[model samples]
Target chain A: MSSLEIKHLFGLRGVSKHDIRLILDHAKQFREILERPVKKVPSLRGMTVVNLFFENSTRTRTSFELAEKRLSADTVNFASSNSSVKKGETLVDTLRNIEAMKIDIVVVRHKGTGVPKFLADNSNAIIVNAGDGAHEHPTQALLDMLTIEEKLGTLEGKNVTIIGDIRHSRVARSNLWGMSTMGAHVTLCGPSTLVPRNTDLMNHVTWEPDIKKAVANADAIIALRLQKERMDDALLPSMREYRNTFGITDELLECAKDKVIIMHPGPINRGVELDSDIADGEHSVILDQVTNGVAVRMAVLFLLAGGRNNENA
Target chain B: MKMRKPSSSEFPIAVLKNAKFWNGKSFELRDEVRLTSGQNGDTIEYDCKGALVLPALFGFGLDFMEPLRDDVYTCADGVDAMLRGGFYGGLYESAANPIDDADKLTAAENRFSSFGCLGSSFDIKFLGAYSKGFGTDSLAEMMELAESDAVAGFGDGNGVIPHSRFLRLAMEYGKMTGKRFFFQPMDKTLRHSGCVHEGAYSDMLGMKGIPRIAETIAAYTVLETARFLQVPVHFKQVTCGETLELVRDARKKGMDVTCDVGLYHLLLDDSCLETLDSAYHILPPIRSAADRDALWQGVVDGTINAISVNHTPVLRQDTVVNFEDSVPGALSLEVALPAIWNKLVAKVGEARAIELLSTAPARLAGSTPVANNVVVFAPDKPHVVVESDFAGHVCNSPLLGAELPSSILAVYINGFWKEL
Candidate 1:
């Protein structure tokens, strides 16, 4: 199989179907490695990876660290709050200093859009976007895609509904591009205030303000977390009203097809965006998404590390 | 006001031979238009082969932040830059610091007159601020300011007054002075700290979206008020399709309303934000492709009267920040003409472009195109826009590094001809 030829996973907006399949195919191998007792690979033994997160994260950082360790690659973790960034160092300066140490790749997460693209343009090392503001979160979309493909077989002709604050969800943006590119009909469902008006411009993507109508015939339902900070901006009336209007309950699942997969990118607001029972229910693949994240990221790290060899080939 | 006869002794007569000249209405090929020499200098003949000589371009609602922000650019700097871009005159809005009192207005008038006497190849007509400090509630010394013959009209620069009643009151007061009020229509609440146009691009780029409704709603308010009050008002730098329709409807109703679009808005769309480049960041924001096409339609249908540079010179450092943090406005004074000729003239035709750039603006400023004020340009010449080519102080133009398809060859103003 052809390997992914990209140096960075900035977003899924421009990633081709073939490259996505290549990433998924490689992820299968990494998933098998995760099941092994030793759970280690020497594919990236001599390589170095750095987790440079300007934003706070728990699961993504730990997941990346574990993935790097599992591949036998040397890893460094730098949180912006404690680093020289607190001493007024810029994003470029911090990355440049890290690059001076012969780093092979920089996994970055920032609150600013296109930060990874900026670094990828300026630095020689591979730049992987963990998450960047409301722009994109490609790896999250890839893991979610991997989970969907695992549960529902081929993505083509499947109906997938993404419900939440799409205007602020980088996850939603990336998945909109990814799922549609994979030939799935994607429906964006949320409050009218939270859903963007021009989603019809994207292929195979439609927006519905009503949650019931959006999930009625979907084969897969991905519920996004409702950020509480949106209250301050007056984007929402209140958490109680939003939960009443858009929160996914088990009753809501009855609207979808039987055996329809339910997913959420984690740290779920137990009773806000989704019901507590449903989050831990049979249909929910929340934990599986986290498990698949490691394998998907491992595939990403492996393919990008092998990019030079693939280019020469 | 008495029109000055074309004095042969006071103004130099230059024979422009074999050129296409736009004479307020349409382009006509002239074999020779003899210009008599003033006592100051000898008349020189120009063989304007294949050159298009048009009435001097006037920048409506132009801002030069002198006196208040003299460190950025002075009046002389603004005049010199306009001359370089083939413009011989502009209606100067009171910007940064409002010229509210008679003394400040007279000072500005004297400064412009002195600049004119220096043979600067360009003159400025000042628009005294309608309200003190350009505030929404308070009125300035409009009648006294109008006494200075140099005051062309009254404007709040690009600021939209927040209160409708206050705006009506200001217009009522301004009506007595017989000066037209110039304002940009925008609702403060809808535009609330937003930087870019509200659309898919703004959502995807994560920039705050300022909906077209912000402008449309405000335009409706202004048009309704102007219709009711029966006071002449000019809307400056109008951007959206609905606003143009509003203007068209107002004119069909025979309301004395005229509107102008910014040169940047006519040429760019919201897609420029995809690059997240701060250079494209501007007030009122470049809108969607549909909005852009509608703006061009507005131009074609005669709904848009004139085009302004809306030129606010920004320092290079101010533009290098994050897209949201970067200041709005562009250094377009020096590049407006060539950029427009390259981007617009072919689609709209040369005569119409000249009307939008010259006649309409001069008429709005309550001035007629004088015989001596003219620009000669080659419409087919191509030149890349670089920072080095600009004579202005700021280099924050979005068209920097672009190859434009026209160049200004010469400009005649007052009693002198400048070969640019």
Candidate 2:
């Protein structure tokens, strides 16, 4: 498909930097709209959103719910703990059940990849991948870019480094796309194996095994929260060792350029993938990423939840 | 090879002459085999042989092993499975070699995996014809060599390209054989040559070695291969967190991928090699302390499904050499239980050890490791210390004089037990 027009925003697989620019550019106007006299508009007053999370997630579920509520759309949270999914229900069954609820959009965070696309295919509801395995987390990617642009005012030629478990992170996939598309030179620095070694995928992406070298002189550095569940995966040898070598601790921050912004997709591991100091530091845009998640997601919910297009309005 | 009735009933006779071993080199049975009883658990008599025995043992009979340089013809053995094609240094049409440097395999393939073809490289123009020719060569070679000197084919295979090509071949060959193929990709986390664990041992000794990546990548590759093949593939030995994660995540994805951990992997880490005992070196190298803890979790949580000796037999001198230059191998089929128990009983216990070495691996490998590699040890047997009277061709058997619990009595193989 041509990058000229977006056929879908289902996953970051075929989409490129241009799509991200267009989406974020559209999101920028929405951000400005939110700054206007009216906070709630009739853009999506009656449509419904099915927050179908087969995996338990507090921040993603809550953020999407808040985004929907702020956009005046009816939000329904279908958690796996109480759903028939526990009774051997396939994802299709769950999505079908929600489809019967007349939901206009489905924001799903599944433990496996392709579930979002599958849901997007089987039903009329637009499927926004809340997170899908380690593949792609688009909205998180979009909000992070919003956070970057807000601080630096421009992203072109900016060096942005994403550090963490690249192999198992949807966040990394999205941010890499969103940042690189907006003219930022994205460098992914991690243990070489965790970094995607596909050279073509590494377009404009400089893979740095040496963490120190990758973090220095960057306009923005986004630290992904290495899942604690991944400890068993043994991505990092030990928690202490990872924090020392890869974590954005006070010590690591000392190496960053004075204006380098640190953003983490959070529920921080305290001193594991990041130090508590840095997570709560002045240079952090982490809190901003959270704030923008709601707004950008609000925009997404508005668009997907049947907001009138220019012609229809 | 039965001994006289009154030799040593107390120790339990084990056929020591059938001593087979593997080192990515010559296969042989140059001496007498000795057998004894068992130590801690996995109660059965033990005779620590190596991969060289696969051909004799499988004679349409049993199965076993970790990475004793995997199968050349069969898709069952995972590592270097590319050798199955037996076409040295030629191109595998639909396959891509996974390893960055795979051409180095052509010569090895001819000497090892092939029966007749001496051509270099794994180039296969017509898979159907090549595979037929390949399988026919095995028959021809078997008939060519008299029964007295014939080493039966146990599918010792490899490929000429990188690992990816081997994977593609395995998938195609698997379709023909109807065998289950699984995957476990290498965790790209700890990328270099992560030999020993990366924790206290490497840090304290100021030594640098492989971290979690080596095994994790192996595991991830397994999963990816399994996905590509759409088959149930199991990684034979997994060592660290990244690998464990790959297995766990793959399983969660409904991928028919499983993993096994070696006793040494779950027991020792890089710390074991800090003082420089060559016996500590082995492939899918050791991991860090936390990776060790994760291995235990991998075991406790039922994530690691099987265990192997990774039984790549090493000669004593080589194991005793410099750490980097020293070959990484040792037999764990005989010591897996006791070694695990030695390290775990205090923390987890004997039950956990039993689950890891016995019931678990047997179930994973389909009712037990191949017969030729099976050992029946009595838990009450005295520890077999290496460095003293260790069997096998290596004067440098790493465990020599090093007490390995359990005495091996009779090894069950091909419908008969080889007596010591």
Candidate 3:
């Protein structure tokens, strides 16, 4: 397929496998372009893309901006802190004003779930969800998938385990949906208090309460950041207790396969979710995930903006 | 049918010919009937062939947002939706504008009363706030308002009353005054900002779950407190079947407790959340299918006493947001009767459904029946639920664009027969 079945990259829940394959294949081509001496592409030379971040983000925003710049698209950054959004302008009104500026694509990150779909419904521009409150981070998941595929050759029949704060991570949700679609087996490991309650989502994956057992058979283990506010919410006891229990340390890796890769959707709570060594070790592909993020995003932007692969260069 | 808006209290005395009604078991036909008025005002006669005549509905625990001065719809739109749905009277919640004092209460009552020119004196009553601005420190200045003409009952209009010492004192005060208090059973901490029922569906959708224990534990506490104090209480928006077991046991022991469920709760469930349609984002979020079925059983076995339309009118802009951010409630009054009829009345015969929708809620609201006030609904008259069909401004509704199997044809209130 030359194009995606879906017009908007809302989430991966209902995304077809064929569309995912197409995006991944194009991402591979983009990754090759990224390594070239002259990396910029003129595909979207005249098109304007707006980055509407209602919530604060570091890497995801920077990665998307870098990808937009690399694709030669005129990028406008709209941050909520200094924008009219803080002046009591509603989301729809702000979007209408942006659309009035003739923007071609809208990449939004909102604290509210399903905001991407909401923007897509209200405006004419193509929507890319950078992250939507605990709902999904589609591009992040796409990059994770691309990283896994690059290292392991294919996602089919691979065992991918995700640990810590499974209940609230948009990264885990998107990864589960996207990775599972590519025929990978997903195992969720976390404190019992943090597992998503009574969900059929558990039916699609195995739940291992023991961190060692969870990572034992994994081809890749993703350690999610443990937010400190969870202690105030009484979702956890303390960071020390969580680290001792479920954190990805070198000691915990002894039970895992030798080739088992380690990943984190970053700004990692180093000692809390992953040890420094585990995050930087030979098996660590954390930085690779960030690099693939730009390429995957380029593929997403190109696909949604209706740019063909080779024609984009 | 397009209705000619009537001035308040200017109802015409008319004779409805060949009207049919549900006599418990089936639809029974009646010959010419004279609907009279206290004042012999404008008299208009009309033939009501093939129409189901029933008492105008009195909704309980109903809510309409405080008028948004800049928005398209206002409090009058809510009144129009209720009247168009065949409701003559309803107990309005003071949620949007908290009623902590006599002034706010009187203002709210007067504001609702002003819409009387559009419909019959829409007997809108207000539930006094449980505490001062819903604070836990002290009870609201409702001791004086309780004796006033405007107070429907004592309860928090917007949220659940925390099980604090303040709640116990409020219960004692309610007991001393011999007034009914409404309890919205819930533990907020346990609810954890969940917007959907805690279950398989919420898990799959990655939305936070509102566990059933949040209602059950709070309900048990409320039930025990009311029983101990010998105070009469009513549970509003009871959504779980587990809570029903407690209510049934309490009633069996004659604890002087009663409960009502949202009209939409019986018809929908958490599975509907899969669509992520913000319209289905209701508070005390639609529970599991098992809970929906249990609610039906509660209705049949008389465990659930009445149905409230909970006719909340959120602005069109507020409802178009994401599922989690979208405000709860749908503009239900315009489509309530048809939805209830197609889902309930048609299958179980009209008497029981009418009792749940009209008679029971009226009794709960302590309304003395109006002799001539009646609704003429046409079950065979199919109509599409559209924005233009609403007497109010365009608003949010789950039933919009829906094809309902029935429609309300006209209403006779204050001796006037208004075709709708």
| Alpha-carbon RMSD of each model | 4.9, 24.2, 3.3
Q: Give the chain B TM-score for each candidate.
A: 0.91, 0.54, 0.92
Off by over 4 Å in 1: A5-7, A37-52, A68-104, A118-125, A308-313, B1-18, B22-48, B67-76, B106-121, B204-206, B342-349, B415-420
**TM-score winner, 1 or 2:** 1
Tens-digit lDDT track of model 1 for B135-200: 876899998988876677888777765588887888888888888878788888999878899887
Candidate 2 residues B1-420, lDDT tens each? Answer: 111121111222344444453212333553544332332222234444431222111111111121232221111221122121010111111111111112222322333234222121112211111122223221212212112111211121221112556555645554443344433234434544344555444432323445555555555665676677776665645666676777788888888766666656666766565345556666656766677788788777778765544544454444433354466666543344434444554545555544455445444433333323333333445675543222223333345466654444444332223333
lDDT of 3 by residue, B224-335 (tens): 8888888888898889889999999998888988899987898788888876789898887899899999988888888888897877767677787788878887667778
Worst 10 residues of 1 chain B by lDDT: B1-10
Alpha-carbon RMSD, candidate 2 = 24.2
User: How well does candidate 2 score on lDDT at residue A75?
Assistant: 82
Model 2 chain A lDDT-worst window of ten: A1-10
Worst 10-residue lDDT window for candidate 1 chain A reads A195-204
**How far is A138's C-alpha from truth in model 1 (Å)?**
1.3
What would the per-residue lDDT of candidate 2 be over residues A93-141, giving only the tens digit for each residue? 6777889978777888876545665566567777788986655788888
